[model samples]
Target: MIREQATDKRTLKTIRYDADLIVVGGGLSGVCCAITAARAGTRVVLVQDRPVLGGNSSSEVRLWVLGATSHMGNNNRWAREGGVIDELLLENLYRNPEGNPLILDTILLEKVVMEANISLLLNTAVYEVEKSDEETISGIKAFCSQNSTLYDLVAPLFCDASGDGIVGFQAGAAFRMGAESREEFDEKFAPTAEYGELLGHSLYFYTKDTGRPVRFVPPAYALDDITKIPRYKRFNAQEYGCQLWWIEYGGRLDTVHDTEAIKWELWKVVYGVWNYIKNSGQFPEAETMTLEWVGQIPGKRESRRFEGDYILKQQDVVEQRTHPDAIAFGGWSIDLHPADGIFSEKPGCNQWHSKGIYQIPYRCLYSRNVTNLFLAGRIISASHVAFGSSRVMGTGAHVAQAVGMAAALSARHHLLPRDLTEPARMQTLQQELLKTGQHIPGITLHDDQDIAQTAQLSASSEFILTELPPDGPLLPLTFSAAQMLPLPAGPIPQLTAFVTADRDTTLTVELRKSSKPFNHTPDVTLETKTLSIHKGKQEVDLTFDSHIDEPQYVFITFLKNEHIQLQYSQLRVTGILSVFNKINPAVSNYGKQEPTEDIGVDTFEFWCPERRPAGQNMALRIATGIQLFSPANSLNGIQRPTNQPNAWVSERNDPNPALTLTWPTKQRISRVELSFDSDFDHPLESVIMIHPETVSPFCVDEFVLCNDRQERIFHKTDNHQSRSTIRFAQPVETSSLTIHLKTNHEKAPAALMEVRCYSVS
Candidate 1:
C-alpha cells in the first residue's frame, strides 16, 4: 500500500451515530444512566472523556461510592439507593471484594459494552453542541484522542452528567455555581463566604508494602516542606486513598475551566504528603511502603449546578418533604468542605444529617431552559446545601437512573422532558422506576398491568415474630442497643430479653418510635419500664403499657449498661434487625447530635445497625406473635421494607418454603418479576472497604418456579441481586403459579418482597 500526499485541507475521520438518547460523561451517574436507558429499549450513545468509565470511582480517581446509606452512620434504616447502582455494587463485591480499582473499571466498561443498545465512546470529549432550533440540542461533536476520530452524535433526548454541566452550559441552560445565601432558601446551615461557598476537589493515592526498604526521592515539583499542611501530623501509612479525603483544594478558582490548575495543586499536596510519610522520620513501619498509585485527576465536588423547574433546597432535605413527582431519594448529610481545603484552619468538613430519607422530585432532574436536556449527577437542580448531600456517586447514579428511564419514556411517547411533569405521566414514570427496582421514598408500586393482583396468594408457612432464641454468643453492651419492631396501632407487646449482668443493677427499658411512620429514628418515647437485675444471667420481661396511633417501627431500647452482656441470635430474618446507639465520626455523629445553634438541622439520637456478621438481632421472646409477615405481602406492590416489614418471610425451619398464587381462570404470562431482600441497608462502598459477605444473608440464593401442572418453568441459582426479572421464551398459560425459595444462609429465613406477573414481555 502506498500513502497519498497530504492535501491542503485535512480533517479527521468523522463518524456519525444516530441514537434515541445521548449521555455525556462516564461517571457512575452517566454509566448508570446509559445502562438504564439502553435496558429500557432506547438506543443510546454514551460519551466519556476518560480512558475508562466511572469518573471518580475509576482507578484514576479512586473515591468510594456512597449515598443514602451514609456509611451506616445515621438512622436511615434499609436506606441504600437501589436500581442500577445496587447491581453495580453487588457485582463489584462478587468480583472484586478487595476493591481493586482496575476491576471496577472493567465492571463499568463491561456493563456498558454488554448493553447492545448502547454505543460507548471512551476517551471521547464533547467539545461542541449543536442546537436544533433555539432551546433543543440536536447533536453533539466529540473527538477521541486515542483513535484520532471525530464523532457527531445525534439524539432527541440528552442527559448531561458531565460533572460541570458541559452540555447544559453549551445549550444555554440556566445554572448556578456558587452557594446560595441563607435568605435565598431559609437554610441556616448555609456556609458563609468566610467558611466556603463551594465544596472543593479531592485527590487520592494508594500505598503498598514492598516487603523491603524502598527509598522514595521527592521530585522537583513535590513540596519539600510538609509542615505547611495543617493536618500533616495526622497522616499515616494506613490513611491513604479515600481515607485522606480531606486532601482537597481549589474552591476559590473556577472548578470547570481551571480544573488543570486544581489537579496540579492536588498532585502537589498528594506527593508532598507521601514525601512526609516516607522521609519525615515519623513512622518506622512506612519504611517498606511505596506509593502504589496517585490520582491523575482531581475528583470534583461542586461546579455549575443546572437549573430545573424546581430547585431542591435545604428544607426539602431537612424537613423530609415529599414531592408529588418524586422519582428517587437521598439520605447523605448536607456535607460541605471548607474553602481553604487542605490549608484551611477550620475543620475538614461540616455535616448535618436528617432523621430520614427525603424524596427527589422529577422536576429537579431536567433543565428549565434547555427543553431537551436532562440534568443529572452533581448538576441537578439543588441548592448548594442540598447539593452537598446529593452529590455523592450513588445518589447521583440513582438520579441519573431516573433520567435514563425518563429518556426511554420520552422516546416512546415523543414528548419533551418538561411534558413528563404532568400528573399522569409522573405516576407512570414513578411506576416504571419502581418496576426497575428503583426505590422512591413513601411510594408504593401499584402497577395496573400486573395480573398477579387478581390471584390468591398462599404460603407454606408465614413468619411470625415469636422469638429469637438465645442460641448464639453473648456480647457485651458497648453501646445502647435496641431491637427494632414493626407494630400495629395497638397496645405494645411484652418482650423478654436474656442478659448476663456482672453486678446487680437496675435496667431501664424504654419503648420509642419515630414521629413519622417510615422513619426509623426513635425520637418519641412511648413507654418506659425499669427492671431489677441480678448478677447472674436471667430473662427480663419488658411489659410496657404503651399504645400507638398508627402502625410504625418501635424501638425496644435497652439503655447502655457496660456490666451487662446481651445474648444475640444468629437467626437472621429479612426486614428485622437490632440497632445500636453509637458514633460514626465520618458523618459528624458523636453518640447523639445536639447542635448548639439553630443550623437548620435536627438534634436527635443516631440508632444505626452494625454491619453483618456482627449486627445480629438481640435474643428476645414476644408475648404474642406479631401477625405482620403475611403471604399477601408479596402482592402489596412494595419491594423494600418501609413503615413495616413489607416482605413475606418464611417461618424458621420450614422444610419447604414456598408461595402459591391461584387464579380462577388460566392466563398467558410471558414475564415475571421477583424481588427479594438483599439487605438494602448496606452501603456496599465500591472502593477500599472490604465486606464480610458478597451476598446478603437475607438474599434468596436459589429459587424455582412451577406452573399449574407442577412443571418447573424456571429456576435461578447463585442469586444475589434484589430484583430478578424472568422472561419466558414461550408464553406459559397456567391457572396457578408457585415459587419455591431456598435460603442462602442457615441464619436467614426465606423471604420474598414482591412477585409480579405480566402478560407482556
Candidate 2:
C-alpha cells in the first residue's frame, strides 16, 4: 500500500502566501537560485514536486555532485569561482565525514532551513502559470500533495530553474527542443540536420562491502550478452556500490506521455542488472555486500530549452567568446549523444567540442518574448550541441546564481531582466557577483610578483609552533600572528604542518588547514587529531623517572580550534617504544591487567608536515617498533598475587597492538628513522623519549601532533608528550607555531618536553 500524507482539500484554499520571488524547481539550480535570492534579502519560495531537494544528486537519483574540474581533471575552474557553492563544499568537508547521501541531505536541509528569507515547500508541483497577456507572468498555481489542495503564489519575479523550463513554456515564452542543423550555428558538433529528440536519462544505485562470504542471484529476464556493456565493464562490482545501470532514452516518443513506461523499464533494467551480478557469482562476497539504496527518480539529462533574447551557440563555446553581459561559464566539451534513441547509434555517436570552457552570455537566461520570467539550469537557450556542454549541474548552479541575482536586482530596481543587460547595469551585477565569490573573467586582478615572492618566502621559512589549552573550557587558538598572504599572481601558496600526539582524546577542528584573516573569530576549526606515534630518536621517546604507588598512562595531543587559520599538507608519525608496569615488583603484586585495558602504555602521537605549492612534492618516511604475540596465550600472562583482589589479566601475551598507516606516496623525501626503549617493561618511570634522526633543517608553516583523532588539529600543552619534533626541508619565514592537545582521558596524562622551530642552514 502507498501510505502518503493525509490530505485536507478544503483548508488549503485560504492560506496566506508571501514571497518576492518564486523559484519553481528544487534541483541544484533552483536551490542555488532560491538561496542566492534569499541571501540577498528577497523573500523566496522554493517549490519541488519531490519530498527532497537536489534533484539528480539526492537519494532519488544518487548521482554524485561532479564539479567542473576535480582531482581527475583540470576543468574544475568553476569551483574556483566560489560563492554559496564554496560554502557548501566547506560545509560538506566537515558534516559529511564519509561523504554519503544521508549526510548530503542533512546539508541541503540545513542550508534551506537556516536561511530566514527562504521558505521551501516540498511535495508541491507547479501546474500552471497565471500571466498577464503573453509577456508577463503574474503568479503560479501549485498543487500540494500533502494537503491535496491548490495554492496561488504571487511574485514580482519568477525563475524557471526547472530543467524543463516549465514556467517559460506555460507563460507563452518561445522555446526550442532537440537539435539544430549544423548550418544554424556553424557548430562543428551539431547534427548534419535538425532533429526533435533529446538525450536519455539514468537510474543509479548504492552498495557496500561486508568483508564476508556471500552469493549472487540473477534476475529471470537478465540477458548475458547485452547486460555486459563494454562501456561500463571497467567498474568492479566488488569495490564500488553505486552503478549507473538504468540508462534509457526519452522525449522523442512524447516525454510527458512516455515517462511512466520509461520509469518502469528503467526499474526492470536496474533489477535485472543487479540479479545478473548476484547470480553470476562473479563476486563471491556479493551476498554479503548489500545494496544500500536505489534511486527513487530517473535523472533527466535533457529537456526543452526556452528561447532567450540571446541564443548561446556552439560558436560561443568554441571561440571562447566573452560576452559584455556574460553571467556564467561552461567547460565541458560539446558532447551530443544520439537524439534518435539510446543504443540507436553507439553512445556519443554525434559529439564534438572546442576543447575548453567559454563565456555564456546573460541574455540566454531570460525569455526573449516574456518579461517577468527567467530560465536557468538545463533549459537555458542553447543549441543542442552547446547545451550538451553547459547542461552539467555545476554550470547550471552558476547559471542559477546569475538568474537569481538578476531577478533580485530587477525587483529591487523595479526593472526587468532586459533592462539589467545594459552595460552599466550589467557591470554592476558583475561587481556584485565577484564580491560574493562568483567567478567572472576580467575580475580577479592581483600582482603576480608578490604572489611568487610570498610562495618562495613561505617555502623557505622555519616552522612556528603554538600550544593550546587541553582541559575544562576549550578556547580558540592561533598559529601565525601575521595576516593571510595576499592572492599571488601564480598558483596559490599553501601552509603545511606535521602533528604528533602522546595520548588519546577527542578534538574538534576544521578541514582547511590554511585560512584567511578575520575580524573577530571564526567558529570552525580546520583539523582534528587521530591516533598516536612512538619511534626511536626520530619519532618519540618518553622516560618517566618518578616512582608511584599506582601505575598511570601517559598522553599527548595537538588541536586546531576556531582562532587558528591554517591548511594541512601532510601527517607522519612512528610508534617505536611503549613502557608499562608489568615488570615492576610492586605492581606485580596486583592481578594482571585486562587485555582490553591499557597496560600502562596508553600513549598516542602523529606528525603534521608542511604544505607546499600545488605542483611541488615533499618526501617523508615513517617507521615503527613492533612487539607481537598470540592472542590466546597473551591472556595467560595476566598474573595476580595472593593479596591483590582487583588484579586483571595482561594483554602482553596477545602480541602488541595492531597499527595501520597511510600517507601520500607520490612525494619525494629523505629517509625516516625510529628507535625503541629497552626498559619499556619496567614500572614507576618518569618519562620515555622517541627521537628522530638528525638531518638538514627546513621551515614549516605550522605543526600539530596529538593522540586523539578529534584533538589532532587543536593542540594543548597540558597533554604534552615527552618527545616530539617539527622538521623542515629548508628554513621558512614564519615565526611561531600553535599546538593543540587533548586532556579528556583520566588514565593517560600527556606531557610535552620542548617546542622548537629551527633553521636548516
Candidate 3:
C-alpha cells in the first residue's frame, strides 16, 4: 500500500462526537459517573487524559481506593459505598485478591467499554472549551497524542470530574485552591499557615524479593541523602505502597501547572529512598529485593475545588447535617496533611472523624456560576475542611453516581442540573439512588410504583440472636475488645463470655452505647463491672445493671489483659462484629483519639473490627433474645444495618429459607430487585491490599425466583453483588412471587436486606 505525503502545514486527523452528556476524566468518579449515566440510557462521552480508566487507583499510581469505613478505623458499620464502585471492587476481589494493579486496570477498562452509551477516549487531554453562553459549556476540544488526532466532543450537559478541574477552569467556573481561614466557617480544625493550606500529592513504590542477592544503582537524578526526609528512619523493607503514604510533596507548589516538576521531585525522592535501602546496610533484607515499580505520577489529594450553590464546610461534616435536597453521603474522616510533606518534622496528617455518615446535598453537586456544568470527585463544592473528608475515591465515586443519575434525569426531562434540586425532583433522585444500592444516610426507598410495597410478605424463618457458640479458636486479649450487640428499647440483658486467665487478674467489663444510635463509637458508658478471675477457664457473668431508651448497638467491652484469653465463635451474622481498641497508623487511630489542641474534634476510643479469616464473633450468650430479624424488615426500605438489624435473617438450621410476596390480584411485574447482606462495613480497597474472600459470606449465592404457579422464573447462582436486579424477558403476571435464598458460606446465616418489585423498570 502506498501513502501520499501531506503538504506543508498539514492537519492531524480530526473527529467530532455528540452525546447527551459529557464527563471529563476517567478516574473512579468519572468512570462511575459515565457508567451510571449510560445505564440510565443517557448517551455519554468519557474523556480521560490517562491511558487507563482509574486515575490514582490505576496500575501507574498504585493507590488503594478507600472511603467510608476508613480502613475500618472508625465507627461506621455496614457502611461500604455501593453501586458500580461496589461491583468493581467485588469483581477485583474475585479476580485478583492479590491486588495486582494491572488486573484492576483491565476491570475498569472492561466496565467502560461494555457500556453501549459510553464513548471513551484514552490518552486524550482536553485543551479547549467552547461555551454556548457565558455560563454553559457547549463543547470541548482535546488531542490524543498516541493517535495523533484531535477530537471535538459536544453534549447538552457537562460534568467536570477531571481531578484537576481542567474543564471547569477553562470554562470560567468559580473555584478555590487554598484552605479557608478558621474564621471563615468557624472551622476550629482548619489548618493554620504553619501547618499547610492545601493537601499534597503522594508517591508510592513497590519492592519484590528476587530469591537471591540483587544489586541496584541510583539514577543521576536520585536523591543522594535519604536523611532529608524526617521520617526516613521509619522505613522498613517489608512495607511498601500505601503503607508509605507519607512520601508526599508539592502542596506548596502549583499542583496543576507544576505537576511535571512535582513528579520529577517525587521520582528523585523515590529513587533515593530505594537507593538508601539497597546500599545503606541498615536493611539486610534488601539484599534479595529489588524495586519492582515506582509511581510515574503522584496521587493528588487537593486541587481547585469548583464552587456550587452550597459549599460543604466543617460544620456540615461534624454535625452530620441533613440536607433537604440530599442525594449522596460521605463518612471518611476530615484528613488534612502538612504542606512540608515527608520533609516536615510534624506528623504526616491530622484526621478527625464524625459520629456518623453525613448527607451530601444535590445543591453541592452543580456549579452555581457555570449553569450547565456539574462538579464531581474531589472538585465538588466542598470547603477545604469538608474536602479533607469527601476526597476519598469511594466517596467521590458514589457521589458521582448521583451526578450520573441527575444527568440522565436532566436529559430525560430536557432540563438543567439546577432544576433537579426541587423538592419533588430531589425525592425522586434519592429514590433512584437507593434503588441502585446507594446508601444515602437518613433516606429510604419510597417507590410508589414498587408493587411489593403493597404485597403481604412472609418468610420461612426469622433469626433470634440468642448466643454465639464457643466453637472456634481462642484469641489472646492483646487489645481491648468489645462485642457489638443489637438490643431492643428496654433493659439491657445480662451477658456471659468464656475466658481463661493466666493469673489471678482483675477483669474489667463495661456496658456502653454510642451518643447516637447509628454510631458505634461507644461514647456513652452505661455501667462498669470489675470481676476477679482465677487462672483456669471459666464462664464469666457480665451482668451489669443497665437500661437503654431505644434500640441500639451496645458494646460489651473487655479491657486489654495479657493474662486473659477470650473465646471466639465460628458463627457469623449479617451485622454482628467483634472490634478491638488498637492502633492503625494509616488512619492515625491509636485507640483513644484526642486532638493535640482544642480543635473541636471529639476524643473517643476506637472499636474497629479486624479483616476476616480473623475477626470472629466472641462466644457469648444472652438469656433474653434480641429478636431483630423479622419478615416485615425485608420491606422496611433500609437495605443495611443501622441502629438496628434491618434485615430478615433466617435461623442457621433452616434447610430452605424463602420469602413470599402475595398480591390480591395477578400483578404484571417487569423487574424484581433484591438487596442482600454484602458486609457493607468492609472497606473494599481495590488495590495494594489482599482481600480474604471474593464474595461476602452473607451474600445469597444461590436463589430461585418463582411465579404463583411454582414455575421457575429465574434461577441464579454464585451471586456476589449487594444488589441484584432481575428483569424478565417480558412482563410476568403472577398473584405471588417466592424467592428461595441460600447463604454464600455456612458460617453466615441466610439474610435478606430488602426486596422490591416494579411494574416498570
**Candidate maximizing lDDT:** 1
The TM-scores, one per candidate, come to 0.99, 0.58, 0.97
Model 3, range 187-222, lDDT digits (tens) per residue?
Answer: 998888756778788889999999999999899999
* lDDT (Cα, 0-100) at 159 in candidate 3: 95
- Residue 60 of candidate 3: its Cα lDDT? 81
Write one digit per residue (lDDT tens) for candidate 1, span 516-563. Answer: 889999999988788899999998888888799898899999998888
Per-residue lDDT tens digits for candidate 2, residues 92-196, read 543453546666667777898899998888898888888777688889998887887787888888999877777877898898877777677665455543234
Clash counts for all predictions: 0, 128, 1
Ranking by TM-score: 1, 3, 2
Least lDDT summed over 10 consecutive residues: which range in candidate 1? 190-199
User: Deviation in angstroms for 431 in model 3?
Assistant: 0.8
lDDT of each: 0.91, 0.49, 0.90
Evaluation by TM-score, superior candidate among 1 and 2 = 1
Query: Any runs in candidate 2 off by more than 4 Å, and if so which?
Result: 1-16, 75-81, 192-196, 210-235, 239-246, 339-356, 444-761
Worst 10 residues of 2 by lDDT: 678-687
C-alpha lDDT of candidate 3 relative to the true structure: 0.90
The predicted structure with the larger TM-score, 1 or 3, is 1
